[model samples]
Structure formats: C-alpha cells, structure tokens
Target: MDDLALSVRTARPEDAADLARIYIESWQDTYAGVISHTLLGAMSPRTHTTRWQATIRTMEKHSGTVLVAEDARFGAVGLCSLGKARDGGCGYDGEVYTLYVDPAFLGRGAGRALLTGAFEAFKDRKLRSCLIWAHAQNNACFFYEAMGGRRVATRTTRLLGELTPEIGFGWKRLAARKPARPMQSRSDQS
Candidate 1:
C-alpha cells in the first residue's frame, strides 16, 4: 500500500456504472458462502446502475455524500456513501451507509482512502462522530476495527427474506485534517 497512489473524490453520476460493478463484485466476493448463490446471482448491474445514479443525485440534492476512490491506472476501485444517521437511537451524528472496494483492488489502500474521505466529508458537515454497520460475519469488521472503530452495538435486519445480523462500529471523535499539498515530481522541479 505504501507504493500505491490513490485519490478519493466526490462521486458523480458518470461513476454509477463503475460503482455498480464494484458493488456487485465486492458483494459476491465477500458474501459468497454466507448468502445464497441464487440471491447473489439475482443482482443486476443495470438495476444497480439506475439506483446508483439516482442515489448520487439525491445525495447531492440532500446533504449526504458519495465518494469514489481511483488509482492512477485502475480507474474507480472503491466507493463509500455516507450522511446523517438514519437509524434512530444510534447516538451517532454521522453514518457510513456503504463502503466497498472492488475485489481486484482490495488490500491496496482504496478502502482506507475512501474511509478517510468520508471522515473529511463528515467534518465539513460538522458531523463530529461516525457509525458504520457491517454484516456480523463479514471480514470488513476487521478492517473497520483496524481503522479505529469500536464495536458499540448489534442488531438484526432483513436482507432479501433472511434475518441478517450486523455489528455497529462507532467513532467517538474524528480528527480534523488539513488539505493535502500537491506533490511535485522531480521532472517538474527541473
């Protein structure tokens, strides 16, 4: 990850397809054994694209945010959607609705970059604390823990028809970050 260069940006409507692909691929990779193959196979890229496009628009219209992570050569590798807390009684000012990295790009720092971007957006919105709910069985929980989140709660929700359990990870405070300075290449310095 040290050598990988990644950038996070606000997602636009044009990124819907890329996000859709990432969503499907990541879901398949992450939930294969836990979720039924039939259910996973039912995921539709076209439908996801439409939903994501509308979602991006709505997020922009509202105060929420959608973020995309890109590599210099691999294009869009990950996405994160976040906004005000939706579920009541969470005691969190902000919530990360979804965070997924393309299967091929996992462990390459895309997730890290996107989470960092989400926190920055939180600060801009004056959201001082954050919460993320992930499937109880998903490995993403480990990643969230590595990112300084504390396990605060758990609950069950419906996914398709099955009752799915989730773990809530909370961050009591977010550190303010300064704007990054652009790097100058040696060739440009000459």
Candidate 2:
C-alpha cells in the first residue's frame, strides 16, 4: 500500500475531533460482540467528548507521545499513545496507552505502522521495555502476539457496570525488532 501515502505525526490540539471520531469508530468496530453494546453506547461521543477533549488538550509531563496517522486519501485514519508507566513500578517502562486504526485501513498495515511509531518514540527516550493492554476477547490478541509481545497477566474489571477482562502484553527493546512479514505480497500464491 505504498501508493496509499500514510503519514504519522504528533497530534495537535486541532485534531481532537478527528481523534475522537477515530476512537469511537475503531472501538465500536473492534469491540463488537465482545463488549456489551450498552457499555459501548454509554461510552460513545456524547459521553466521551469531555475525556477525549482533555486527552487531546493536556500534554503529558513525562516522555510521552501521541501520534496520528493520516493519508491524503483517507484523512485522519489512525492514532496511538505511548508514555511511561504511571506507577513507576516498572522502572523506565513505557506503555502503549492506546492504539486504534480505522476499520477501513485494517489489513493495510496502518496499525503496524502506528505501533512502530510508538516504539520509536519510546526508544528515542531510551526506554528498555514497553507494555500494552488489550481486551482478552478482542481479535487484537493475535496481532499483539505477532508483534512479539508476551502475555504477562490478565485482569477483570467492571466498566460501565459490566465485567470486562483485559490482557497485558510486554515487549523488550520493542523498537529494535524488525517488522513482521506482511500478510500479503505481490507474489502471493493465493
């Protein structure tokens, strides 16, 4: 998809609306059938605008980065957030706070590219490891595994008054690893 011409850069305050749209669309698409529709509905634009606005407006004090992926053809298609672990329990540990790509961009390498950008940001700060949490029932579990993340733990919690389970993945020197082989190629026999 080289012809797609995607670009990843830090998000600006002006991007709040686009980022919020992507978050809602991606979450709804990715969490369908996994998270209760009621819960998702409760967390949609009307309920999440304030939180998303604050996220886009407030800059983290630590070595953190938020990136948005755009394409001339697709506009703001994906976004990711990475930062130091909040509690300092894992010294110098970085975290992939959020990573989401437009459903239309799925299978086009947008998610992988966004994650690569996040890793590079962490590496620039000299972080040795990174952590990411994914919903256990979400298909992204396989994607995280393919990215070389090892499952470290799982936790269940009540969100929006419904039980949800999240799986944690860890990666060391994540930025240093080569990108995974693409699922399709020009010579694919299929």
Candidate 3:
C-alpha cells in the first residue's frame, strides 16, 4: 500500500459528484456503528453535492481550499476540506473541516495524502496550528492520534435526536512539519 501512487489537487465544480460519493460512502463506512442508523440513512449524496458545489463556488481562494485525492485506477478516492477555525475560541488557527476516503481506499495513502495536502495549504496561508474533530467512538479516530495530534478538547453535539460525543485533536507548528507528499499546485486537477 505504501507504494501505491496517489494524486491530490484542488477540487473543482466538476468534481462535486465524485466528492459527494466519497463523502457519503466514507461516512457510512466510518460511522455505521457509532452513529444512529436513522441519521446515517438520512444522508443524501444529492443534497451533499449541492452543498459541496456551493462551497466550491463561494470559497475565497486564500482563505480555504478543498482538495481531492485520486488513485491511478480510481478517480477521486478521497477529499479534505480546510479553512479558518469555525469557532475562534478553539485556540487553533486553522481547522480541517472534513477528511474522507472511500472504504476501498482505506489503509492506503489517500487519507494521508489528503491530510498532508490540507496541512500544506494551511502552511501556505501562514497558519500555525490546526484542529480536526471526530466522533469519539469512531475507530478511525486513532488515525488522528497516530498523526501526532493531541486531544485538546471534547464536546457532545446532538445529531438526529441523539447526543454524539466528539473529540478535538490539534497539531501545532504546522509550518515546521513535513507533508507526507508534495502538495500539488492549485492548478493541478485529477
């Protein structure tokens, strides 16, 4: 898996459908046991595509970026959305809003590549630190821990009538950290 070739680049409007597929698939794969079945069943890729398309259209070039990772055989296997911290009180300068990889591509480098790409983007914006949130019960939460993130906070949020506990992981000195792969320029597309 370490030798697999993967590419990461800025996501465009044309990539919405693929991104939505990856997003919903990854969510279903990761949150099946941790989240309510009713809520998971309610996720609509069509609705998400519209939201994603709107996001791409409204993003300020320097403020945030959405990057997609593609395998040589599979296109748009993973994605990551990054930007300013949603809550200014979090003490982190930037946030990884989301990161998801197709279930088939898990354990490969897609997730790492997307994450590395996001960090590079944060560094490009001169951000010093970043944070990401994941459901505490999600098995993939260990991926964050393995990447050197330290648990900084935790909160319970309501989702589909159920309270879900989430853990926040933070990484400081991002500019000093090396990316897992060389991040492609904004002009690069999968």
Candidate 4:
C-alpha cells in the first residue's frame, strides 16, 4: 500500500505484545537457515513479550530508546532499539540492539523509518557513532551496507548451543543519515 499512513514514536510498554509478534515472526523468516533451526524454532512470542515489556519499562534508566513504526492500517509494524554499545571493543559509542519490520511491510517504509529514527535518536543522545550486529549470513547485512554502514568487526556468539558468526556494522556519523522515504504508492492492491 502506497501513501503510507505511518508514524514513528517512542515505544510504550503496551507495545510489548505487538513487538513480540513482530520479533518472533521476523526471526523465523530471516534466520531460519542462518541460525540453528532448533534455536529459531524455540523462539516464543510470550517470552519476547516479557523481554519487550522490561526493555521498555527500563529504557529510560539505561539511557536507551525504543521507537516504533505505526501504520494506520497495520498498527505497530516495525520497531528499533538504540542505546550505548554493549560491546566495549566495538569502537562505536551507540548501538542498535534490534530492528524488525513485519514481513507484510518489508517492502514498505517501516524498516527504513525505524532505522532512520534510531540514527536520529543516537544523534540526539550525542552519541559519536553507532553500531549494529547481524548474523553474517543474513541478507540484512546488505541493507546495512546500503545504508552507509561499514563492517568494523566480526565476532562469534553462542546461540542455542551453536556458535554463529556475527558481523558488526558501524556508522561513523549518525547525523549523516538521509531522511527516510515513504512507501511506494500503487494504484492497485495485490
């Protein structure tokens, strides 16, 4: 659907459920073959709901920010989390912990809105640079590259008892991010 009636705003604890659904579904779709099947299959919306709730409630205390992309027709369709870098050696002072968009909205503007909003948040926080890690095998690595992010490092992390390679993408200038674009408009719906 073009003419996207979308808005980006701070995430609320009440968004836990919708965020959890998006997280679970997006993980399943994006990491099926990249991550262990056992790990991907074990993801639960209920568990993620609790995680999202705690993350939202304690974000301010941690100087973290969460942003959601809401569409008039789809409610909360995308989300992003930004905060101080978790890895001390990442060289970036800020990090995007998570960014996910509903599969139905993937080709739309939700993902870009969430990411750009996160960059804006980082700049607002006076963070020098920002980093995000993705499974080395995930195609989203290309997305990060397309967004002016450079691969700064690589690391291995244990997930579901399997060691997986993760690549860190960094943006040295958060303020350099381009303005987000709206979803493409169409005259007909498929």
On TM-score, the leading prediction is 1
Of candidates 4 and 3, the better by TM-score: 4
Rank by TM-score, highest first: 1, 4, 3, 2
- TM per candidate: 0.90, 0.82, 0.87, 0.89
Runs with alpha carbons beyond 4 Å of true place in candidate 1: 176-190
- Model 1 lDDT per residue over 3-65, tens place: 345778999999999999999998889988878999999999999999999999999556689
| Model 4 lDDT tens row, 1-190 | 3666677899999999999999889988987776777788889888999999999999878878889999876689988998999969368899999999988788676777778888888777888798999888888899888788899999999766678899999988776555366443343344
The Cα RMSD in angstroms, rounded to one decimal, for candidate 4 relative to the true structure is 3.2
Please write out the lDDT profile of model 2 over residues 60-127, one tens digit for every residue: 55678779988766788889988886555243388888999888788676777788788888888777
By the TM-score metric, which is better: model 1 or model 4?
1
CA-lDDT, candidates in order: 0.86, 0.75, 0.81, 0.83
TM-score of 1: 0.90
How much is 144 displaced in model 4, in angstroms? 0.5
Where does the lowest 10-residue lDDT sum fall in candidate 2? 180-189
lDDT of 1: 0.86
Best-to-worst ranking by lDDT? 1, 4, 3, 2
- Count of clashes in candidate 2: 0
Question: Candidate 3: minimum summed lDDT over ten consecutive residues — where?
Answer: 178-187
